[model samples]
Target: MTYNVQIKVMPLKDLLDPQGKAVMSGLQNLGLSGVEDVRVGKHITLRIDAETEEAAKQIADEASKKLLANPVMEFYEIEMIN
Candidate 1:
């Protein structure tokens, strides 16, 4: 069986995201108000061959830890989708 997985990678809350800051600045320049803050992140989708949802989730987690996210400055969340 194959499972669909989604990974969200984002900078740690304690860290500053330069890209997000730039985007916020751009938005303000465009006259967009009421936006207090912005954070930029990456969304990754993967199809994994596994027997069970748990197995697939584990694989995705391993992938995120190994290469998808930088543990030093970033964090990742994984979800199994239909």
Candidate 2:
């Protein structure tokens, strides 16, 4: 079977996100005062061949941990969409 997977990778909450802060500052400078505590993350979508939904999810999780995300500085979430 084929499965669609979605992964979200983000910096750890305790870590400083300079890119996000820079964007937030830019937004504030552009007169968007309501925006606060902005955080930036990556959303990845991919197709995987697996026998079951659970297997697909496991593959996604493994990929996220091993390659897509930096375990020391970032975290990831995986979702399987059939």
> Which candidate has the highest lDDT of all?
1
Give Cα-based local distance difference scores for all models: 0.96, 0.90
For 14-80, candidate 1 gives per-residue lDDT tens digits of: 9999999999999999999999999999999999999989999999999999999999999999988
Error of 1 at 12 (Å): 0.2
- Candidate 2, residues 1-82: lDDT per residue as tens digits? 9899999999999999998999999998898888769889999997999898888899899888888999999998888765
Clashing pairs in 2: none
Report the C-alpha displacement of residue 13, candidate 1, in angstroms. 0.3
Global Cα RMSD, each model: 0.5, 0.9
TM-score of 1: 0.98
Q: Candidate 1: where are CA atoms >4 Å away?
A: none
Give the runs in model 2 whose Cα sits over 4 Å from its true position.
none
